[model samples]
Target: MKLARLGSPGQERPVVVLEDAVLDLSSLTPDIDGSFLAGGGIDAVRDAVASGSLPVLEGADSLRVGAPVARPSAVVCIGMNYAAHAAESGSLPPERPVIFFKPPNTVVGPDDAVTLPRGSTKTDWEVELGIVVGRRTSYLDGPEQAMEHVAGFVVADDLSERTFQLEISGGQWSKGKAAAGFTPTGPWLVTPDEVDHRALGLRSWVNGEPRQDSSSRDMVFDVETILWDLSQYMVLEPGDLVLTGTPEGVALSGRFRYLTDGDVVELEVDGLGRQRHAVHAYEAAAR
Candidate 1:
């Protein structure tokens, strides 16, 4: 029962995370997206915070956390479901799932501030696991019906640029994955009955060092078989956000060196939290 989204960026507000405070889901739902997780809203915020009737989020510790879900309609991704990150990007492990799509306005905010685009030299960093769909999936019938259409789990990064994703704009990888903030997801969203999305634990770091530690149990294709192989084609609505890929130390196998201009990306997964950004240099925002 985590589900955050504090203030700033489109005026976020929804909240819930507790262990000692932060409740107010805006009088019970106004934006956790996908119409509040298809209207169940994590069982109505766990029975309104176990009947205490929610309403504590006063300061929420100086607000500004955003991206805990809100503004999604598709941000799917899944390339190289991690078989050593598909042999370190040279590629070879693909029996199915390798979809792509990252442009739901390139959602940002898990410690936002990453630009590095403008003839970018390769700017990489991945660390994923994000799911979040909760209803309206399509053509399921497998992978245990895609775990009843999931409704939680965050911690994503997927910020690539690798020469606009593989050299030019023809191979088609969301054209180097929709730039802007390049996805950088949430600080919480959690809920699939609490977590254990197939043995979580996917690490990453850049300026602080360690690149990508890896372990969604190596994931050759886990987590309800990538939502039953993306519901056979496409339709996952309800706050859509997939991701589920990155691992095997990034920097595109060159071993390291790509992101520049400050470099600081730190990501984590374990209990679905942790993300930090800091590479800037792209300005251009005066239209």
Candidate 2:
């Protein structure tokens, strides 16, 4: 099932998507957050849908769509998990999964404006598949066990500022990745049963020109394995977001110019959804 949140930032209401129409789920749950998911929100929503208990959301089309889920506790990321993406960024595929974290506040709605950090010139884009966890998981035995913990998937744009990430930060990538609005996620959070996360077609474009064209099939460490690996070191909590790296064709590869003010980025993942973000200059007090 497709689930989403719609309204202004910080005031979104939960809704379920049925083809072209939207049904309000606010009567059943206040918001789709860690607590809600942990308490069997997906199952409850499914029952509500089957019992014809949810009401059609009025004027949902006019409201802004927020990230499918509320801010997660952590936004974990895998670095260069896609072999071709590693090659383009001038590196070899790693022997182990490279992990990093983007503070939860970095997440923003899919269509929001992305601010270019002051004095930055190498801002770039990455199209990634985001995994949302549904249960508390720790020290999972294997990939099969990891799959049982997944709640759904969403389209994630892992925007980066190259200078802060590679040259100026003394080697920690999160410095460049943790900027507000750097991670734009969702139009919907699609359940695992609705998507074949293993082989979806994922792509990205800037200013209407294609930049990245690849598939999830190219991932060096697929979803389940990455989750299994991460679970060994840290507990995967419900509503935790994991960005499973990007594929080849990004500006960091020296193929295209970095993003500038007014640039638009569009990303899409098969069976999940699409996102569009406009680049803008950073304002000191803007939230």
Candidate 3:
């Protein structure tokens, strides 16, 4: 099953996409929340689908979409989880996953404009696979157990402000990663049963030109390892999002140029869905 949030930012309503049609799950008995997916919520929705009791959403063409999950408790990101990306960034792959956080406010729906932050000049893009946790998990037994914790998957653009990321500041990378609207997530949140995580191919395009193109199989630390490692550090709760890291071919890879105002970035992953965003320069008074 594929879950989504539809309508304008701040006014988004939960939805489920099956084939070409969208279902307004908001009208159902179960409330729309992150835990819905993490805590056997998918099973309920599946039963509803089979029973034909779910509302078939019409006029969905008129509603704008937001991030699938309304408000994640935290957004965790993994750095250099892709060897080729690490190599391009002039660093070797880490022996263990490097973790960071992006404020939940950074989350936004797909197609929303990504505002370049003030006093920033090196904004860049990263297309990553985002895992949505379905339950509270601590010290997961192993990879298989870790997989069970995942509720679904979504496409995320880990938009970055590079200068603030590595320059003058000496703090964590989260500073550059947590800007508002920095994370463009979800046209759809596909359940694990509906898609094969290992076989999916992800690709990103900047202003209609392709940039990152790779498969989840290329991940140095796959989804299971990431979830397992993450649970070891802190409790993984429902609605927590984990960005598994971007594949090779980012601008930071040194093979292409960075983003500028009015540039549109597009990204997609097999079975999950696609996301698009327009880039604009930040104005101080605008924030």
Q: lDDT of model 1 at residue 111?
A: 90
TM-scores for all candidates?
0.36, 0.98, 0.95
Number of the top-ranking candidate, with TM-score as the measure: 2
Worst 10 residues of 3 by lDDT: 26-35
Candidate 3 residue lDDT tens string, 1-56:
88888887677777778887887777553444665765577787788788888777
RMSD after Cα superposition, model 3: 1.6
lDDT of 2 by residue, 18-134 (tens): 986799999989999888889999999999999999999999999999999999998999999999989988999999999999989888899988989878889999999999999
For model 1, how does the per-residue alpha-carbon lDDT over 1-287 read when each residue is reduced to its tens digit? 88888898999889888888888888987788998889887897888788998778777889889889887978888898888878988888899888989788788788978887776888888989988888999988889878788888899898989888888879778889898778979888888888888889899888788888868888889989888878888889988989888988888899888888777889999998898988876753321
- lDDT computed for candidate 1: 0.85
Candidate 2 accuracy as lDDT: 0.93
Candidate 1, number of clashes: 0
Q: Which candidate should be chosen as best, given lDDT against the real structure?
A: 2
> What's the true lDDT of residue 234 in model 2?
95
Superposition-based RMSD of candidate 1 using all C-alpha atoms, in angstroms:
14.6
Which pairs of residues clash in candidate 1, taking residues 3 or more apart in a chain or in different chains? none
- Alpha carbon deviation, residue 264, candidate 2 (Å): 0.5
